[model samples]
Target chain A: MRRAAVSTLLWAYAAVALLPLLIMVWNSFRTDQELVVEPLGLPHSPSLDAYREAWVEASFSTYFLNSVLVTTLSVLLSTAVSLLAAYALARSRSRLMAVIEQVFVSGLMMPVFLMIVPIFYLLDTIGLASTRTGLILVYSAVSIPFSVFVLATFLRQLPVDLEDAARIDGAGPLRTFWSVLLPLVRPAVATVVVFRFVPIWNDFFYPLILVRDRARYTLPVGLTTFFGEYQTSWSTLFAGLVIATLPLVVLFLVATRQIVAGLTAGMGR
Target chain B: MNRRRTAALPTPVALLFLLPAAALFAVFVLYPMATALTYSLFSWRGTAQDAFVGPANFVALFTTEPYATQLPRAFGHNALLFAGAMVVQNSVGLLLAYALHHRGRLRRLFQVLYTMPYLVSPLVVGYLWSLLLSPLFGPVNAALRAVGLDAVARPWLGDPDTALWVVVLVTAWQWVGFPLLVYGAALGALDPAIEEAAMLDGASSRQRFWHVTLPLLMPVIGTVSVLTFIFSMEAFPIPYALGGSSGSPAGATDVMSLLFYRTAFHSGASNAIGISSAVAIVLFVVIVGISVLFTQWFRRVERRLT
Candidate 1:
């Protein structure tokens, strides 16, 4: 009886968790009129009209491309810089290095709202305001603290005998780091990459504030406006949401282990 | 091998390795934070900085008409969100984790399923929930009416009484997976011998859980609480997506972040920058202070456990 009760509770919670998405995908194929008439009913004949309308008319294609470009560039830039810094912080025993590490770690507490106004002014001063490049740069900066913390923690736990052996084999510092250390920390790198990717992909704040041009809008910002414009067209709005959500779902399915590992890494003793 | 060769990178090369991240962080994160501190001290004429008002902006924030009222209300909402998340999300997560730990069947699949909502954007999640809860055409109401329970159906997102709770529930729905995974991992790491010994001592499952497992899980619980506190206090996207930037339904769902956004960008108040920066600084101090204090306390507790 207890085992049955447990199973029932788990299954119920799982249904609650997934039913919304399933309903969304199920309804996206129906027309707005059909949805208004029967909000809970299945589509009579599934169609791609809503998808086509969202993709072609609503400019989700552009938003899709922009999201892809911005998320990819920002994650790559932040992860690359953080890896080098993590390596340095892991290896160095200097007092200054410790201070620098503290500086980066302290950034974990820095609120985005606090820095946003000044960042706007600073970006404008540098002529980067409203540009994808500027947004990418800000994303990188915001992501660096967490990336460094995770990578540095992982790097510290690694044994250094491999690096010593590489040095004995006449490998230079750069060569040793690139060839020896990099391969070993691949899991850490993957952890940082997955963790950074989701937030950057999902962030609407920076883009909403910094980017002015419609052409430059990322998916989250674009979807907000898209919803505004398509307020009456529920099916099309659902289609747009599905488009915004599908990539992450697919990615999660592909990389569940890595994502879980990254999420649960430091939580346990 | 020498200890130096084994551990230490040469200083020059280490600095070189650090340069890119240091530069980016200094220019973007550190510099802007410093500038925000400065901006919060002064008066502003539209976009331009004016006379140094010392703490007048902060004073106005606490004592003035709109801000005094708005700040406290928004702060209450945030506190409510934190408390709600702790009671609802974390508790549910612990139960789920405990069940999964014992069952072990389809654990990976369940983890993936449970965590799926977290991977999607909050904006999308918010929008999706808004549709589901929409009074006019939402299936929730439709199903309610269909079941002859029409009295239970109402404007969930439109009602001020229920709007903030909806946000809380949605936020919990998206994030419960985090605590679940964390607690699950902590449970897995626990030595089973202790629990077995308790079983031998004739402790009931409930007694063992309450006395043994719960105390051992205190550190992980503390960590989850701090994270939930931070996320709740800084919440934006769901509230923004569901309630708009002004935190609609007559500002019933207004949060500190939304308030800051409005004052800075939308309000067009003369000293918008100054006032908003003050708001930001207040939130920062609160978040950092509470987080540090709790983390230290949790560390002491963890040390005692061993």
Candidate 2:
């Protein structure tokens, strides 16, 4: 009886956490009248019109692709950098570690809002401001500290014997990390991908200022534009929200186990 | 053959691995931060070739109308948000972790559900909460009335006194699971015998937790607290959404992030990149100083605890 009641309370707490999303999903299905009139009730009948018009008319497909492209490039770039910096921090008791760690932490203080000012100037000077490359570099730079911190933590926890054994066999530093360490810390990569990548993917502040062109607009900014253009159309806006959010939801669903591991990786040590 | 071939090229090999990140950082991060300082010195708006003003921007920013008010509010709300996150996120996380500590079946279900909020964009989180608290038909008020608590309900995001806290709560709701998951792992590593020992010595469940569990979890708490503090400081979404495009309700929740946004590309105002750059510089210095202070404080606490 106690266990059942405890589980019930836990479920209630979980439901509270999920309440807004549940409401979003529920509201997205209802008609405007239904939404306002009986907001909490199940739709008398579900309709696909919102999802359909949202996808076809609003260019949500393009926004989705833009998110995919930006997130992919950003995560790849972040992961690549993190692997090297993390490896160095993990293996070498190099005095450089202290300095580099300081750099990373300070770099975290570089607000994305502030970066817009200088980066716009820099990118314009180089003719890359509104370009995809501009957003990619900005994202990778901001994310470097986090990626390095996470990857370094994971890398430090691994046993060093395999790498040592490989080094003795004349394997180089790069080769050992690639063949041996990469597989071991795949979870860390996934964690970085989820945590770091999601920010860049759904990054509204950057894409809003940096990329003015509609063609290059990532999902977050694109959805904002969609909201302004179709300001009165709540249904379509909700639909776009659903579309903009699906990829991360998909990523999370696939990596559900890894997500837990990722957060817990820092614990105990 | 083995010895000679093995010794071939280990020096530049690892250097190649570090190249991508280092080069990107040099050109983008390092360059931009340097340029921010240089741009601060100049009065131009970062467009069209113009003459440099040389420290004029900094002087004006210090004495200017918005900067004087702007810097403090941004820093103040930034501090408040940091505090809210620490208390709400850390406490709630610790509680959930405690609930899940001995429970298994419920753990799997709750873990997945709790993590859903962190996966979405903060803007969206803000938007979703706004939807729930719309004053027009927000489900929050709806629930209040439903449960016969109508007297206690209020428009959360519209009021001055409540908007900041609403933003804080919305932001916390999004990331609390993350810290909890982190702390849960920390708790699991704690020696079960410590709690057992306390229980045998006539300690209550609360006492065991307070005396035994809490101390052991300090390091993880330090890490999660610092991470939350830094992210909350720079985070732009909660204030932007809850405060609306204008960061409104008379700029009550207009934080540094939003202020920097407004002064720059105009998060909801006019676009003046020069002044925004100056704001950015100010924000950068303040955040760095705060980060240093936080680390020092954490070090002090760690020392005392040890």
Candidate 3:
């Protein structure tokens, strides 16, 4: 009886969480009026009109492409920069490592709003504000600390004997880092990629501040343009939302273990 | 083993990796923080030139008629959101984590489901929930009718009075799983026999939980709370996505971060950078104070626990 009760509560909470999602998907497949009238019931006649409207009317394609570009570049840059820094910190074992550690930790906690004016002024001074590259730089800088934390744990746990073995085999430090340590940290690297991608993909803040032109809009900020002055067509907005959300959700469902392992890197062990 | 390597790298290679991160952080973090401090003292425009206005800006921020209305509301709104998240998010998280601590067949399934909302973009969440809570034709209203609770229908995110709480509810829903998993990991590391002994005693489940489990959960709780507090102060996207930063319905949902954003950069405005930097500086000091206090508390808890 207790077991049954527990499962029932579990299922109910799951239902509460998933129900809104289901409603979004369902509404996107129906007429807006139909969604309003019989929202709790199955769709009377589903259609592809919302997706069509979102694409043709909303210019979602531009935003989607922008998201793809920004996500790819930011994740690549941040992960590359942090990986080298983390490897150096791991191997060298200097007091400067403590400074590096402190810098990243505070960066992690430092609210992005606190730096908005200065960064904007500086970016604008350099002629990069309101551009995709500017957003990419900001994303990379903000993401470094946590990525370092994740990579540091994994790299520290890595056996130094592997490097010793490679060095004795006549590999230099750089070559040993590549041939020996890099292969072992593939999971950590994937973690960094997804970690940066999901946030940059869905981010509305920096884009809202940085990107001025609608032509340069990323997905999340572009989706808001459809909201209008008062109300949006609910069905069409839902379609736009689903398209924007699906990539990360699909990736997450497939790689649940890696994400969890990354999040709980030190704590789990 | 020397291929010209003696405990270091050639300068160019070291600079190659470090330069990008260092340059960005310098321009963004260090200079911005310093700029915020200087900007807060005087009135200035987008450019470097400024007028020496002394502490007039600080005095104006306090004694000005408009700020009187703004400050209390911003702090109050954030506090309500913070308290709501602490109760709803952390408690639900602890319960879920406790229930799912053992790795059973359904473990992976629940984990994914719990973390699913977290993965969705915050903008989508704000959009999705506002749609769900729409009074005219939302499914929530339909479900309320189906369940014969029509009288409980609410304006939800629409009304000025209830809008902030609606944001808080959604925020809690999205973020709770994080703390739960953090605590769950810590709990999994604890020796089971100690908990078993307490349970085997004459103590009730409640007694054992309070006298034993809650105390043991303190360290993780401390760490998680500090993280949550910092996050809560910085959490702008959901509210911004929901009602917007200037806030809807007479700025009812405005937080300090949003206020600063609006003041500094109003939809690609050409100027107002200096004024916005001043607001951000005040925000920085507030954040630094809170984080330092939490760090001290975390250390105290750490020392006591260990």
Top candidate (DockQ) = 1
CA shift of A131, model 3, Å: 1.3
Compared with the true structure, what per-residue lDDT tens digits does model 3 show for residues B1-306? 333223344444544555566666666667766666676666665565568777766666666545557766776777777777789756777777766764465876777777777778877988888888888787877788899998877877778988888888898888776776677777777788988898788777678767787777777787777767776777787888778777775778888777777766663433355455556666667767986897897778767755
Candidate 2 CAPRI category = acceptable
Instruction: Please write out the lDDT profile of model 2 over residues A106-206, one tens digit for every residue.
Output: 67556565556667778888999798988888888888888888887887778777777788888778788889888999878888887786678777887
lDDT of 1 by residue, B268-297 (tens): 799999999999999999998999998998
Residue B143 of model 1 has an lDDT of: 90
| Candidate 2 local lDDT, residue B175 | 79
Tell me the interface RMSD of model 3, in angstroms.
Answer: 3.5
Q: Fnat of the models, one by one?
A: 0.81, 0.51, 0.49
lDDT by residue (tens digit), candidate 1, A149-250: 999998998888888888889998889899999999998888888888888999998999999999999999999899899998899989999999888887
Q: Which stretches of candidate 3 lie over 4 Å from their true place?
A: A93-101, A267-269, B1-17, B46-48, B267-271, B298-306
Runs of candidate 2 exceeding 4 Å displacement: A1-8, A81-110, A148-185, B1-9, B45-56, B148-156, B267-274
For each candidate, the alpha-carbon lDDT, in order, equals 0.91, 0.75, 0.75
Q: All models, DockQ values?
A: 0.75, 0.44, 0.50
Which candidate would rank higher by DockQ, 2 or 3? 3
Q: Rank the candidates by TM-score, best first.
A: 1, 3, 2
